[model samples]
Target: MKSVHLTEGRPLAVILRFTLPLFLGNMFMQLYNLVDTVIVGRFLGENALAAVGSTGTIIFLVQGLATGLTTGFTVLTAQHFGAMDPKGTRRSASNALMLSFGVILILTFFSTLFMHRILLIMNTPAEIYDDAYRYIIVICAGLFSIVLYTLGSSLLTAVGNSRLPLVFLMVGAVCNIALDLLFIPGFGMGTEGAAYATVISQVIAALVAAVYIGRKMPDLRPYRDFWRLDRGMAIRQIRVGVPMALQFGITASGTMVLQTAVNTFGPTAVAAFTAASKMSTLLTQGFAALGQSMAAYGGQNYGAARPDRIRSGVKAAMQIDVAYAALISILILLLLHPLMRLFFPAGTDTGKLMEFARPYIYFSMSCYIPLGMIFIFRNIMQGCGYGFLPMMGGVVELVARVIPAAVSMRLGSYLLAAACDASAWLTAGLFTAFAYHFYVIGRIEQRIRRGRARMDASPPAPKKE
Candidate 1:
């Protein structure tokens, strides 16, 4: 029953309230990942670390599908909520749950079946191939938990209850860290240990969220009769969800190609990249959180037929994102070495690691502004029920990233390979921004005009006195 209704408040305050929990939750998730990397690099050594890192894109490819689809599913739910249609909201949520579960099952089956082949295709080094296989296989087998957690959290966020999900994530992060220490060092489970820890933590979070929704959020619970598929509803969600899923897949596919290129440089480059990527991910959490807030904000306003408010929210969000990006970029560059040092042990030689990773870190920080804008516009458009354009933007990004990495491979330059992400963010940002401005915003303005016209044409009320 408790939710932040974005349709009623100051846009900036509402969005920031929504974003704070998301930002903190994301930071915790990143910290957990950072700890995992640190533990592996220090305890198991660089080859073990590289093995885990090599699987990042493959993991993203699978997990991103779940995230993207679930996100798409929730957009309709958010809209229904904003329209104050309880039945519509519950129906949308039910269908989303069923669809997401089905897709996750298929993904898990294929991913686990071909884990070794995927690693091989990524050009995983001979020394770390077996370890990578071990890690990713466990992760793939447990994809169900990830789906459950993502779907549940997304459902809650859709209704503007971001705080509970953050609490669940914090609990999961703590559990994950505890398990990581116990399994890796105490039980000597190696990379598989890290994988197990992650999966178990997700399971815990998912179960807790499910229980909470069942007991506390009766508004979201669909009746037994609502379980049956509604073809029209399914179509609506799929219309929005599938392109979003493909966007994640396509974007991840590009990262896979780039990862393959990185692997060719051998284990050291891979490890350095892994560390740098983790750091960049940490710094960008603010943007990601802000973007998510906009999706909910835009969705609710759109359903309420308040297109003008959506515009105002996007502008406010962009201003926040830009300022955060600027500040974080400067801070990251300042602390690059100190932060990079945390990935390894107290006395490990980081000379080679720094040499390979520093330039990549610099590129990431320098391009934060564009990257932040990419999240803002892309998510807002998706919230507005325009998935195809964002997916096309992802295609542009795929091309931008893959081309540079491929050229880097031919030229034998890691710097060139490192530049791929910056280029992708820039190109994709421009594409998304243009699409929003030229197409989506124009459509939104038409909605606003119609709303105003309807009001203007209405008959005046008689005086009560």
Candidate 2:
């Protein structure tokens, strides 16, 4: 049991070891999403699938916020782990858990209370509103499990241990798929059944991860020293977490705006967008897993004061991301229709809707490298305890989505909805590029300069001479 996942002294090995499990874990998580849709579409019909689709934006918003908090926890854990301070790591982990639980509770309460209102505001179709409301409410009610799982997993990833979480997620995903089949098809529970299955799976993941950490990861077990809340640590965690939360919230709000634009085009467009987005997510998971690897690798090394190794890790990540994105983009473009049909099925309006969505899918796929670069850069910044620039990237995404969406709706063209997405990626790419150069690269240079200055300012060793 090596204490830190990153041996700053060997950056590539650390990244590969940490990333492999994260990649598999993310794939399993995506399977959870795919299975939910498959169960709903196959068993409950298209309308039930639409109902689940209706709540996607809202769920992203809430889940994104929870994940942002988890990012803060990861940052703290990564830094402490890098510095070889187990006590500090434990304290940060405890505070992050407390903070995450509290935040999820508030989000769950309000989201459930305003479920109907939010759906209405999103212009969710009248036919699907009731089912959507039910689905969202159930999901919201189980927010604690979602938050806990994310928190625990982030802690593990932060400490360079992605395998434990990956194993637990695999178990949970299998259980979720079984439950989805049992509830939706066997029990005829429909959309509510899918939501219930998801929550149940999340709960299982959280419990399993928690037990594993408590038993295996001595650094994470809550002791009396860790139990005591330090005001300074709490403040630092919040300071880092809040902006990341806002970034996700803002980004999710833009997705809602895009959702509203899609809604105006009717259910066909909504269904198409939903299906396409799901496929895109599955593809992006490959790059995202790599990016997560970079975060842990970079953060630990940055903490360990190995700036050159951090730079090398980011470079390796960029190359991996670019190559992977290029391959994936080609595959997506070549197999668009067949792939879409698999998710949407034939002899249905979904297949036709997917045809309308082909252009959007192809265009978005072309930008995968840039999109991946953004993730790599953002995660590197996050690993280095810098959150504001990435938060600014969120602002860029929000404006790009909102303004284009508004214009497109006014123009009465659903095509603009896809355009807005591409534009947002382009805009976010610019910000990510700038941050990579100015913040990450610049910081590295500054550290080097300061080191030189200290040497120059040092007094002569005259006594030795």
TM-score, one value per model: 0.96, 0.93
Query: Scored by Cα lDDT, where does model 1 land?
Result: 0.89
| Residue 249 C-alpha lDDT in model 2 | 94
| Structure candidate 2, residue pairs in collision | none
Tens digit of lDDT per residue, candidate 1, span 1-465?
A: 486678988888888889999999889888888888888888899899999999999999999987898889889998898889889999999999999888888899999888878888788999999999999899999999989998898888888898988988998999999999999999999999999999999999999999999889866889998998778998999999999899999899999988999999999999999999988898899998988888888888888888878888888887898899889988888977887787776776788889889989888787888898888998898887889999999999999999999999899989988888999998998899899988998997797688889999999999899
The per-residue C-alpha lDDT of model 2 at residue 409 equals 87
Model 2 spans with C-alpha error above 4 angstroms: 1-4, 9-13, 344-346, 349-351, 444-465
Candidate 2 local lDDT, 1-465, one digit each (tens): 434557544555666677788888998998898889866766666667777887888999998888887777668778888878888889988888878878887888888898888888888889888888888889999888888998988888888888888888998899899999999879988788988999999999999989888888888777976776678998888877888888889899999999888888777777677778888888788777887777777678776767777778877777777788888888777876766666554477655676557867876887787788777887888777778888899999899889989987899877777877778887897788788876766786577568779979999787863
**How big is the positional error of residue 280 in model 2, measured in Å on the Cα after superposition?**
0.6
**TM-score for model 1?**
0.96
TM-score between model 2 and native: 0.93
